[model samples]
Target: MSDEQIDLLFHAAVELQQRGMWEQALTQQREAEGLLRGQPSGARRDERLAALLYGTGGSLNALGRHAESAGVLEESLARYTELGAAPTLIADVRMRRAVALAATGRGASAVIEADAAVRTHLDVGRPSDLARVLQLNADVLADHGDPDLAVASADRCLRILLQPGRPGAADARYLFLAARRASDLHAAAGRPDPALAAAEIAWTSGREQGFAMPSDGLRMVVRLRESGDLRTADRFLKELRGLVPDADPASYPTPEPSVTLAQAMAATGATGVPALDPRDAEAPFVPSQRSAAPFLATAHATALSAVCLSALPEDVPHGVRLGLEAHYLFAYASEAQDSDLRYRFVTHGALWARVLLALTLALRPGDPALADDLTGWARAVVARLPPTTAEAVEIIAAWIPFLDAQDA
Candidate 1:
């Protein structure tokens, strides 16, 4: 491919990445990389190849393929080092690699990489780059079990992001993510007022920018309740529930054993669907089913089954059967992190699945099969979660009851 063709491919890949279609973005990046590899070795060609590798690493990281992301990033770093690339360029990749490392449970190495990136950005004196690095560093520190230091990092990043005339002040994603980080850190430090204030920024910026999740709304409600604003909390809770329908909207009238967990969750939000924001749009080819109605129907049936099961005693055979069915469905629904929607859904759903699965196993601890399955799922949840948010803390703690039962 010619230089112009390569540039076009690179730009297209970047646009796809920005739109949260990381799988397609990765494909474009790899295609460009292959074309560049066919050319003879030169400084320019190598640099182009390195840029492509960096893009590949970023897409992989976004898709939750953290181990692969870290490896690709290492290659990108080596090439940049050989070319004597700019400090900013090197720091950018270092920051992204730190996140990938942190996600994969290499907290110590992640911390080192994050600190180095932060120092480079600080010396370079670019507020936007520095703020971005600090946000990632805060997450790495928090995951590394240094909440106080993480709080400091988050506070600094928020200051940079919120500054009136700063370079990153107007960036929607930067403002929302930084505010959310600061909110979590402040809550952990027992400073409820600051936490609530910061959460307000996160809620407003996230919703307006179309990047907010169901968890974000939940966080706001929790914070409001903590601050003794019960009326406001109740109002927000009502608004949230309003987004979900009270009845099943699917065409199916009966429940099937094959209903996957993703369909169930989609059913929960069948009514009052949110607008499809371009920035949050995933790859078009992701789900085989185009609509949420069928998912909602399956979810409704599953929920009814759970209600019936709840009325039965813990040791009842029918209850056990129902629980196992739900567990298997959840397992079957687990998808690769091919797009942003899947990534977010899995991140939140996996935690709930782990806890529920553990509870079921607790009732039948002698079932070695269920016990082992829960154990593996719990470990995966811990490795993948950032452990920064209050919601994460609470959900992680939910495993304790199951653990206690197992020990008994």
Candidate 2:
């Protein structure tokens, strides 16, 4: 086969990966790998083959096939070294491989690989590449090595990315993610002040860049509350409420169930909704009436019921995990206007309310203050529902007891 065939497949795989179609992306990547494997041995073939392996490894990692990903990435690393690939390219592979290794329970080796990758990038001195590697290294160290060491690495990465007027400074999204990670690490290490500072950075940058969500504001609120700064937390909580939509059903004409779900997702900036079985990784990327919505909401009236149930005690813990993960996807994909207060007040409000409900499930249980914060925001979601929507009414009825239990 021609090299163009391989290139097309690789590009398609990357596009699918970016669209969050990990299973499809892995399939495309493996198809390309097969084509490359069949090619004759030569420098050009070897280079393409190595890159193909790298892409395949990435798709594997995204699909949670960590051991397979590590093996594929290791071969890619060897091939790239033999081809004398650029330091930046090799370092990128090493960082990804390190993550795969860590996921497969080789935390010590993961730290070593990530640390080596960071050093390689430092030697090359590309501001963006070095900063990226350093951030990954910090995460690896935090998970496997010392928290203090991880904080130092995270701080160094922040310094490079936050440098004013530095050529090739990281993008807004990267800066936001790194700051959030730093905040979590600091909070975990019992450094509340630094945690608040880093959380502030994430919140500020996320807003300025139009990617901020209630979750970002909630992070700051949580940190402030934890630090015994109830006054500040209350103020932030007010601002956070402004980001949520008041899901009043009378605000918009009801559409078909699937269309309502789709529109709600669009308003929240969520790309896809999972099927009822979160374990079914092969489900369609988007929800459809014929396929996903019914399976998820059969017990309740509205499609939004799945989101609420997933967070409640009736659902399995794993379902709650999946729901929260989807919630974050919505959070990060959100633009300032997409999730703005009262945007299409009906569906948008319902979606945001359910998202907050899911969050209440994820928060450290037994914190009455935090639980109150979440429940209050979510209750406002269903407070305006029309009596005709029996399904939503049923879910809200159950939700009251859950909220009462929180206070109890």
Best by TM-score: 1
Give RMSD (Å) of candidate 2 vs. truth.
Answer: 21.5
TM-score of 1: 0.58
Q: Note the clash tally of each candidate.
A: 1, 0
lDDT leader:
1
lDDT of 1 by residue, 18-120 (tens): 8899999998998888889989999999999888998999999999999999999999999998999998899888889989887886644565567667767
TM per candidate comes to 0.58, 0.57
- Evaluate all candidate structures by whole-model CA lDDT and list the values in order: 0.62, 0.62
On residues 193-265, what C-alpha lDDT tens digit does candidate 2 reach at each position? 8778888988988888876766667778777866889998887677666666542213322111112223333
The collision pairs in model 2 are none
Clashing pairs in 1: 267-296
